[model samples]
Target: MKKIAVVAANGRVANKVITEAVSRGFDVTGFGRKENNTKAQHYVQKDLFDLTSEDLKGFDAVVDAFGAWTEETLPQHSTSLKHLCDILSGTDTRLLIVGGAGSLYVNKEHTATVMEGPDFPDAFKPLASAMGKALGELRERKDVKWTYISPAGDFQADGERTGKYLLGGEELTLNDRGESVISYADYAIAMVDEIEKGNHIQQRISVVRA
Candidate 1:
């Protein structure tokens, strides 16, 4: 069985991803601020800033479901990512980040990202902007295998797993109703699928319902 490490494993998205990965027979180690409430083989309660490469060694891949909930802690996103990259530099473990959709282009021209558009919620800009900065740093690294997975504009936790979704490039995807949306469950499916397939390498990919 493939061994995987999941950071922030108690978060909604990470919880779903952990469930999916475990269901697929993968051996998983979950790390969270508190005791992991998931069904993984092992659970480690530790701060992301405290994680050392030794703690993450031996996993086939690491899924970063880490996020900042307040403006005061937004910088942790970038800091933690850098720490992970620095420690995993020469290792074979792949890093898969659950990213924000705000960084995705709203049009094919790529002149503007969704976060800069008029429709983006002002209240969420700080969070989106922080995520954008972190993603920018990830794109510049070439030492370790990293893939950033951005969900659609409407990523929700309560939606069902329809077992269907569409993958896009840097562009934000829209459905027949012209809505960009995806359930956390389906997003987890895509994430675990990518973990197993390794189709995307050092790239930013987006997901939405077909």
Candidate 2:
């Protein structure tokens, strides 16, 4: 079985990703600030900044689900990816980032990003912009294979898993209700599917419910 490691494994989305990967029979390990209730083969509680290259060499892929909205931790999003790239350089392991939708285009012409629009909430800007910056960091790295998955603007924590979703490029996708939305469960499905298929290498992809 392919081995995968999930960082920030205690979060809601990470939990669903772990569950989905486990259901697919992948050998899974989890890393987080504290032990979480998970069925992974192993779990490591450590600060993400403290991780070394040797600590990550065992996994076939690393899912970076690390998230933060605070002023102190937000910058870590870029630094964490940088650290991982430095360590995973020249290795075959892939880095799959759980990205934000802020950077996605609000229009079909790709003229403006979601964060640039008037409707986007002010409270969410910091986290969304930080995630966008992290994606920028990933884009500059040449030695690492990375994929960033951006969910819909209305990413719901209580959404259901129908094992169904649609993939999009940098443009935002909206449902019949004209709202961009996705469930965490379905997002996890797309993530593990990408992990197995590896169809989106060194690219940014988006997901929304079908």
Candidate 3:
């Protein structure tokens, strides 16, 4: 059984990912600030602010599902992502991260630019932009096997897992409806599947409902 470690397991996507991983017979471990109420038997309660490389040993893969929306939290998020990269550097373990859609491309001439438009939230622009930069940096690194998965633009709270999705590389992918959307459950499934198969390494990909 492959051992998978998920950071920020309390979030909606992480929770579903953990559940799907567990169901698939993977030995799942969760690292987060608070104890997750899910059925994951191995839960490590630790603040990401205090986490070190030493705390992340013996895992085949690490899924970073951490997210933040405030300027104060951007530094922590960036630091944690770098720390995870550092820990997995030179190791065979993979880092699967939940990335933002704002950085994705909408067309050949325009990118799904965030923080530059009027509708972009002033408070969240910094955080989103920071995440985009962090992901870009991770792509340049050669030591760790990292894959960033960005959800579609229509991501929301409740959606059913149809076990159907479209996958694409750095270029943003959309469904037949001309919108990008995937349920938390299906997103979790895709993350685990990528981890197990080591697909799309060192690249950022997007998933949307088909």
Candidate 4:
């Protein structure tokens, strides 16, 4: 079975990803700040900032579900991600990152408007900006087999997994309602599918329900 390491596996999205990965027969090991009461094959309680690849050795891939983003935390977040990628460089192990939608382009010419709208939250702007920069850095690296997965503009906690979605490259996706949205379950499925197939290497892709 494929052994996968999941970093920052305590969130709702990470939990769903772990569940899907395990259901697909992958040996899922999760690392996070606190131990979740999940039935994952293995769980390791460790802070993302303190753990190294040596701690994650022998895994086929690393799922960075650790949504590390904040204006004040940007420096540490950038350093930690770079460090993890460097440690896993040149190995068969891949890195699958769950990224923010802010880095995606809404149209052929317009960038994603995560922070410009009236409804945008002030608290989330810094984190979204940081994620955009991090995605840029990851796109420039050649040694690390990485894939950045972004969700749709209307991502929420209550959508159902209909087992359907649209895929795009660095471009924002929208549904029939002229909005973009994805369930945590479907997002996890997409990420695991990419991880297992070694798809979308060194690229940023977005997903939304079809």
Best by lDDT: 1
List candidate 4 stretches off by more than 4 Å.
69-71, 109-121
Query: Order of all candidates by lDDT, from best down to worst?
Result: 1, 2, 4, 3
Pick the winner on TM-score between candidates 1 and 2.
Answer: 1
Q: Model 1 Cα displacement at 192 (Å)?
A: 0.2
Q: Which candidate wins on TM-score?
A: 1
TM-score of 2: 0.96
Residue lDDT tens for model 1, 135-201: 9999999998999999999998998899998998899988888878999999999999999999898
The global C-alpha lDDT for each of the candidates, from Candidate 1 onward, is: 0.93, 0.90, 0.80, 0.81
Residue 46 miss distance in model 4 (angstroms)? 1.5
State the lDDT of candidate 4 residue by residue for 1-210, as single tens digits: 999988888888888889899999999999889966665788988888788768878998998876655456666556767877888888878898888876677567755455555667877778777877777788778998888899987777778988878887777777788878888888888888888788788888888888
Point out the higher-scoring one by TM-score: 1 or 4. Answer: 1
lDDT by residue for model 3 over 1-210, one digit each (tens)? 999888888888888989999999999888889867766769989876566666677788889988887667776667778888887788888889998876776567756564465666776668778888887777788998889998876676589988888887666687888876788888877888898888788888888887
TM-score for each candidate, following the candidate numbering: 0.97, 0.96, 0.90, 0.90
The residue-level lDDT of candidate 4 at 11 comes to 84
Separate clash counts for every candidate: 0, 0, 0, 0
- Least lDDT summed over 10 consecutive residues: which range in candidate 2? 33-42
